[model samples]
Target: MLTVYNLKMPHAVYGGENAMDNITAILKNHQAKRVALFTDGGILASGLFTLPEAAVKAAEAEYYVLSDIPPEPSYTAVQQIVDQFKENGADMIIAVGGGSVLDAAKLASVLVTDEYGVKELLDTPGRAKKCVPTILIPTTAGTGAEVTPNAIVAVPEKELKIGIVNENMIADYVILDARMVKNLPRPIAAATGVDALAHAIECYTSKKANPFSDTFALEALDLILNHILPACDDPEAMEAKNRMQIAAFYAGIAITASGTTAVHALSYPLGGKYHIAHGVSNAILLAPVMRFNAPVCEDRLAKAYDRCCHEAENRCQSDSEKAEWVIGKIEEIVRHLNIPTSLKEFGVPKEDLDGLVEAGMLVQRLLVNNMREVTPEDARNLYLEIL
Candidate 1:
């Protein structure tokens, strides 16, 4: 049944506490002299970048620090960073933050060498020309921006989020340091962990999925589903943080290979219109979408459920039972972590349901990946069910 499948990823370097120990050698390998360090203000404020900053300084590479990336990356914001990188003449880029910062750096790194600007790059695919070598160090356990070849950018005027899908956008190196996420806030740990879980689940159930992606997604799902609660309970637990980071990276590979489905497609409008956090939006839509997809994807759901349960045969009598059990487990986790379960609770007015449906319809790229077809009507009903 498998025709073709490919899994893409950066050269990942994983370690605990000593993850940055090899940064110096990596820079030397790339022969990067002038470097641009990209991150957000909050990460810089938290001092997580202190070690990397010191490493760049110690290497005596001419470096410029830009901490102005927004919570959600925008086209205009990416252009500003590109300008800085061009001005500094940086031969290399190092991104250290969550998804937004890493994505912004990815777009800017490739755009800096190309004749095309942000608008042209977003509008045209395969126009990306490889530019400066870049390294991504994630401070959070979610988003998996470290290993993925995709970057999401928001266009405020259009109220739409667009992804730059190009292999050239993938980072040259991904550093997974347990120390960086040791002090992560509880809410972020919960939200990002859920985000990784959604990525794993959606990719596994996507229509394009094949053996390669299934292996990665299931492994990632098992890791996240098992450790998310403990990770949320103890922020400083190194084992939980480490596993979450690896799980997110594995999910990133899965999503890249198979793509995400209706859940991500439906969550986009909330992020675009309400500025709701992406993970929170996904968390709200996860269960309802799974419920809707059950008829077609029950076997897939059951397989995932079995991985979560120690005694699957005794607990789940049928595919329907397994699907419901999986949905119930997700709901339980969301509740325990205090994630709002309804669109209304997330501050979407009842009247705006139609608008949300319209927005969801626009994300055909992700919708087509759903195992079960999701029409505009299906999107509306799913939102209404959540409401």
Candidate 2:
């Protein structure tokens, strides 16, 4: 039996031109005197800080900025951010970059008002009593961390990338200004865009998928498949980039309701052990896992293709064929974007394949969402095929 679904997202969403102007209003509304800003070094160097910094200054709010966020943030790193947020006596937070920074901010905000450690809170979902109000501004168009209740954090000691899912992690406000995504490089654009697409695809095929998740996922898939290439070709094209950003945000909402499946579950170890960027890892595994799941999900994939494919690709004869066509298109996109298609590119020694499989097996929470159950042997073969 299917359970009724509840969608999760930020309280208010601001986008397009003049979105940054609302920051000052939120600060005042909350009577927030001091604000914490979190971002990655790449965004800090991109000169996108001017607007938000000015907004905070104009509101007469003291701002504390932390821009040293790493590619995939770790549990210890977020704990440090939590300490700093509390130490500065920040009453609110402004997360001002991509997924990593937003996730760091999400974890930090929840930890600031509670005594729970990162592991405890993530491991036990509803323990946090409260969290500081937060406003998220996406400098990059992927990860959809702006409105998600889940945050991905790396645990280096265990060589695993884990999700911290909690309702309190949701941001109070989300800003999606295209100006911030203008300088994204071609590779990052391609990888992150595919990452967003994977979120929609995986959720659409997840066991927990319902009418609401399918609606959001299909819409997100449409937006992403149509505009991803245009956005990559011209980062300065605000229209294309805006569409991709919206696609990512929609996919975020979809996954929050239905959750992601084997693709995300299998990719975590690649991220944690090899330090392959999370998006790239997802890209590598997406096609293979989709192909694996196709036998059981052909009708669903056919429906996805029918809704998302262009006129040129819509003439496929059968559902099985259409499913293969969808898989092929993803491969073509990855090739066009110059993403590495194999684990060997990351130089994983063949002998260590077992370790990767072991790590992937541990992500049963996500694996259970797969339309077809993922067995240990199936996991091994999937990695071997990719290798």
Candidate 3:
């Protein structure tokens, strides 16, 4: 834990039932006249945009929809969306989708200037600042893009995803309405739920973990581990879905205060190269990376087990036993979710192992946060386990 640490969050957050209705008041408060709505085709097609659209109309705001953003978008792709936002001349942005859409909108809010854009920020993130305020409405419970200062984009040249970190990019407002995620397809719900699971555990065990992060990270673990299965498996389980939404946001807060470790670092290559969903890639690597770090992080993992596992029959007395149980529980969750546990499902050949190792190693910003230092050999072996 660091002697000095700080926590950052959105200016305001509204959640629970009818949270989407807050959008109208938020628009009025921002005095946003011309609004730019950012999302992808799938969200628009799913009619998930209806609530926010109605809210925007109720505010009597003139809104233009920018729904061309792709999944796991490249920086150039984000630049294109920024250019479209610039051309439309919207004074505010409302992002309504998963991580990719939210991330693209965050980039657009800051990339309005000719001086610097998403590509420039990739190399010098501090060069950009927020020009337009944003309201982020997440359709998935994972990614925590709504509350984080980081925007992840793929760098196609390197075939790896990189995070653009700037405090200015945090959402000005966040609305977490379970209605937005109520009907989410099972596969998406499963992948994203596990992604939040990875975030909570990884942040708790991070070398940078401190009092501020542990507070949220532990609670997030409890909520996610207990609620994720029902949330994903049953369509009518609104209570579980709502808790998962809050858990994802709390996990996102954990990321902002502390950080993610090797799980995220190694998973980036899979998303960047294979065009795999970010949540899916993270789900694939979550257990393996946690197991590898268990030797050094067992004490923290034991604490997590104590917090998250409340079932009387499953209690373990020793730290090692608790750690093993925690890891095993993670594996069980992944298994039950049916998220691919092996890279072979993605057709990631063994021949690509060397390249995967090289790319995963480049993400030192996150790798350094691991309590157990990850070397080139360590990364190679971790990737091989999945491959």
Q: TM-scores, in order shown? A: 0.96, 0.97, 0.99
What's the CA error at residue 145 for candidate 3, in Å?
A: 0.5
lDDT for each residue of candidate 2 in 136-230, tens digit (9 for 90 to 100): 99877798888888888898987999998887888889988877788788888888999999999999999989988898899998888788888
Candidate numbers, best TM-score first, in rank order: 3, 2, 1
Q: Rate the local accuracy (lDDT) of all candidates.
A: 0.85, 0.87, 0.92
Which ranges in model 1 have alpha carbons more than 4 Å from their true place? 311-314
Task: Please give the TM-score that candidate 2 achieves against the real structure.
Answer: 0.97
Candidates 1 and 2, the one with greater TM-score? 2
- Separately for all candidates shown, the number of backbone clashes (residues 3 or more apart, or on different chains) is 0, 0, 0
User: Residue 283, candidate 2: how far off, in angstroms?
Assistant: 0.2
**Residues 1-387, model 1: lDDT tens digits:** 136978777765556667876777887777788888999988988989898888787676788898889898778888887887777778889999999999988888788655787778777858997688888998877988888888888877767677778899888888888888888888888888899999999999999888988998999988988888888898567798789988998898887888888998888888878787888889999988988888998998899988877653567779889888888888899999998888775667889888888888988889999988998899989989887
lDDT of 3 at 285: 91
| Angstrom error at residue 5, model 1 | 1.0
lDDT, residue 24, candidate 1: 79
Candidate 3 C-alpha lDDT tens digits along 1-387: 877999988989998789999999988988889999999999988988999999999999999999999888999999999998999888889999999999999999988889888888989999888899999999998888899999999998999999999999999999999999999999999998898888999999999899999999999999998999999999999999999999999999999999999999999999899988888899889888988999999999989988888888956999999999988898899899988888887888899999999999999999999999999999999998888
User: Between the candidate structures 2 and 3, which one is better when assessed by lDDT?
Assistant: 3
